[model samples]
Target: MGKKTTHKFKAEVSQLLDILVHSLYTNKEIFLRELISNASDALEKARFKGQAEGAEDTVAPEIRIACDADAGTLTITDTGVGMTRDELMRNIGTIAHSGTAELTRLAGEGKESLDALIGRFGVGFYSVYMVADEVEVTTRSIEPDAKPVVWTSDGRTDYKLQELDEDLPRGTKIVVRLKEDLASQFTNAAHLKHIVNKHSNFINFPIYVGDERVNTIQALWREPKFQITSEQYAEFYKFLTFDPDDPFDTLHTSVDAPVQFNALMFIPKHGDDPFGMGRENRGLDLYVRRVLIEKQNKDLLPEYLGFVKGVVDTEDLPLNISRETLQDNILMRKISSTLVKQVLDHLAKMAKDDADRYADFWRAHGELFKAGYMDFLNKDKFAGLVRFHSSGLEDEKGLTSFADYITRAKEDQKEIYYAYGPSREALNLSPHLEVFRRKGVEVLYLFEPIDEFVMDALSEFDGWSLVSAEHADPAKLDKFESLEAEDKPEPLSDTEKPVLDKLLARMKDALGDAVTEVKASARLSRSPVCLANPDGNVTSSMDKIMRVMSKDSSIPKKILEVNPDHPLVRNMLTILERDENDPFIEQAANQLYESALLLEGYLTDPHALVGRVQDLLTKSSGWYVASEK
Candidate 1:
């Protein structure tokens, strides 16, 4: 038989219903998930009780949602341990809480927002008002005196309850009458599927929307590290990043510190996360218990580490919420800091135990390591982990640690000479390395892009300045070249002096606004000329990137230093001797300037350089020569 009836809610119950309806502002839609959460909690409790009594759990352990879009109703039924009449009255009606009256008063005065207060007092079930105009709960108890009970509420001022005789075995069924305006959310199959995936992808049981269980993820982060194999971890990493490439490293840690947490973090084999773009980044995920929380949590780690891909689980999280904005919360901040350090420690361990593997990682992510060296917060730790290919030492397999670099510092090497370019071969071939090699100093070969930034940030390492190889001055040259060598083998001749003066004057005019001065060489030994920044603010590469990025046309000024002893400079000196009024002088000067610019790693416009070379050929090949004889 069936009957319909109504009864007035208790005074507390009416106020509770009011708060539940309007309290949750932004998180209103969570009412469905909250109800599902409570249902799961009930089922878990029931399962625990059954386990305690040593009885087999025969009920299929899953939560299912059936939608009737045409009927304008959605029923969320669970085969969980159902509630009896008194359980409903006490759990649902009275609003189980200790500070219920105070919260109700605080909420009614509108002084406090309802979102925070909703699930705090078992009002998770009331979230239905966020979407539904009315809800009816039909449940049957497992108790001997159990009977089917119906509790109905419009989610406003009051609710009603009644008993009925039916064959609803032993579970809870909640039928929601969608608000007329929002009925489409329940009716459309896709929307229901989206909601299930977004919020409850890893519920303890199969979460069926319509007919099929939408959640298939095993929530593998919760598994014990010993139980998980390398293949399993790699599989999960690929699934997390969608990268067929296996991870280079994995770190799984469970901490119950200032805040409790279980984190499984990995650094992918490739040093970048491909977000469909060619650009690289860190890919780290955050979860709570077995449910995925935030798929991409950037704040937990720094950007240079964008290559990290993994999951973190914490019990402290309400798990019933949005983790996008988790970093601001105190709990998340602790987890973020702790997890980053844990991964770093793992990397350090790799360096100590597996040099070959760590070298592979270094070869790929050396830029990121250098970036960490630049960031003030991560510097000390990242610096210790930096590995580089050294020039003085043999390049076999292992990377040269900065500690080893310190041990190899020269007797009079005032600072650590470092050459940062595209490669060890390139830096070694550079004109900039002449003085360092002449001085018999071991310059650290830095090929990574972030190396310059790290050296600039570090400034000094192990009490020695990080001197760029290109920087002017072979300062402490006593070890190789003595102070007596500053004396020229021969003085600047009176005849050559006038040529130098004229050459400098014409250069100042031709390269106006592009060079501070065209000085005679002092630092140059083998090269004809070299360029240096007068101000020496940022690195040349960074300056060029800035000029191009900003599309600025203003040419940066540079100081030009000629090697007085070089064969090219001597040839130019000889040419100037014949031509005080030489028409080819301008072409000769341009060629020398362009050559210096190329050596300095600055961009020299190719068209003008080609024209200058063509003019040189025209003059040398008798094309512009008057009477070749």
Candidate 2:
């Protein structure tokens, strides 16, 4: 041995090491990831230096991991640029001192490709102390004159360094004497391979656990798009997500401005968490140079796009010392905005180019994607992508986008009309849609409870206000001519207007505070009555959903709009004309109000309405029998 020496660790270095071994990493297995990543970085530096010198016989770079269960030890060897004694001290003997960062600084004025280097915080290597009772590093520098050196440390207070007399191959080898408790976990070949595959599978260098190479999957996102085939993408996606089915769509994009990143995003053929049971763990696997920094990082994408699964590798992110979490949220937000735009642009292109495929995407993800209405930055793009069942469609299965609806809309239409109900059939039967149907106007059907909230957030799209049919103004609708002229009931004969007024007064009196106002509606053509929001504080759909959520059985009072032309209302007017003080009048008014409540999904109890129906049946049956006699 050439001279063996001992050195005390910097005070801060000792403090940081304690943190790394005790509390820094959530998963101790990632120590392997840190070592492999450092090895990869060394290998990349060697490759870049060789390429710069036009070297043709450079050694092929590879990482080899050997697990010795009997010895309770794990060894990792790499064919890369080995560290000089000075470099070893500067890189590993201090806290937050990074070899990769030093190389970057030295290559600053040169046109060097140092971007592949992964170690920036310098603390990653210390993570090995998490699983090791003692660690030894044996390295021989690629420089011909540099002597071989060995570094040994128990990772507590001090370390020893020695010059080796034996010749060794270029690069570094790490031998970890595993902690007694963690020996079996780290010494098993299969477990070691799993750790490599999980964190460093896409590393440029081949990673071997024993003789078998574990990282067989290529980093397709780094490869040129034209060179990668659809089959390859599908294979990679299946390998990444473990989804048996092929993706519905794939978005492979590289962004160079504001932030640089390689994103390989996929819209799965179907959502794995359709019911949102496992939605808590959502977002892309965040990687820095193909090393997974965070898995299912929820910050990578908005919650609305949680269904999207993929990998996002960015070198520009400033990671915390542990490399487990991001340090700068501003940079992350920029990346998020860029990703949102890319996804939106991809979907928009698909919608325009492949309607059938886009329709499939919509069907599989529309319920979740509809939550994007709150993404105000991309509101226009989101508006263009949302699909709805419209009155114009022959069946509920057919869907129309807002753009398509606007295209087919009458020139005078300024509002995009939508109504919320349980289903298309329910919406079709909605009393609020009577006038819209008469005017041959297309109304979007909102079936999901979130649909109302989505519309409320969006408010408007492409200069057209999104107005609920329940809130449609009567005068603006009357301006549009009826699609087909209907034989009209003459306005209650002029002399009978007074009787209709008396019936309205009687109905309002019967309803008491159950209604804000009881008034004849010019918009209603078929339904006897419908409720409208008195002051628009809450929409009918939202109110019903809120009530259901709170388990409140009480019905909210609203404006009752009665159609004078409907036969039910005309008959009620005659009933009032004959006997102004009849109990049937109050019963008939209450029955109409309750029936409207039932249609609006607000009526919790039907006992009174059912009894009234029975009484009406008894009276009508008796009258029919007397007529037959």
What C-alpha lDDT values do all the predictions have?
Answer: 0.71, 0.84
RMSD of each: 5.2, 5.4
| Model 2: ten consecutive residues of lowest lDDT | 111-120
What is the C-alpha lDDT profile of model 2 across 1-629, one tens digit per residue? 87879999977677655545555334678678888988999999999888898987458899999989999999999999999899899888886544444543534534321112223444678878878889999998888788889999999999999988887888999999999998989888888888898889999999999999999989999999999999999998898888999988899999998999999999999876678786786789888888887888887788888878999998876432232235346777789889988888888999999888888888998988998878888888888999988999896688888888999897699999998888777888888898899999889998888889888888888899999988888888888899988656888787899888888888899999999898888878888888888886677888888888999888787999889998888888877888899898898889999999988877879999999999999999999999999
State the TM-score for model 1: 0.79
**How would you encode candidate 1's per-residue C-alpha lDDT over 1-629 as one tens digit per residue?**
44656656666666656665555466555666677776777677778878898989788877878888788988888877889888987777666554656765766687554545552454667667778889999998766668889999887666678888766667899999998977887767788877777666767878888789888877776777899899988887776777888888888887889789877777767666223253334546666665555667777777666667776777887663444335457887787778778877888888889878888888777655566764576666777788777777766344777767778776666577677677667777777677766666677777655676677787876666777766635446544653234433476687778777766776666666667888875556667777777766666655665677799866677887767667656666677677765655566667777777765556547688887888768766885466665
TM-score of each candidate?
0.79, 0.93
Model 1, total clashes: 6
Task: Please give the clash total of every predicted structure, in order.
Answer: 6, 0
Q: Would you give me the overall lDDT of model 1? A: 0.71
Error of 2 at 363 (Å): 0.7
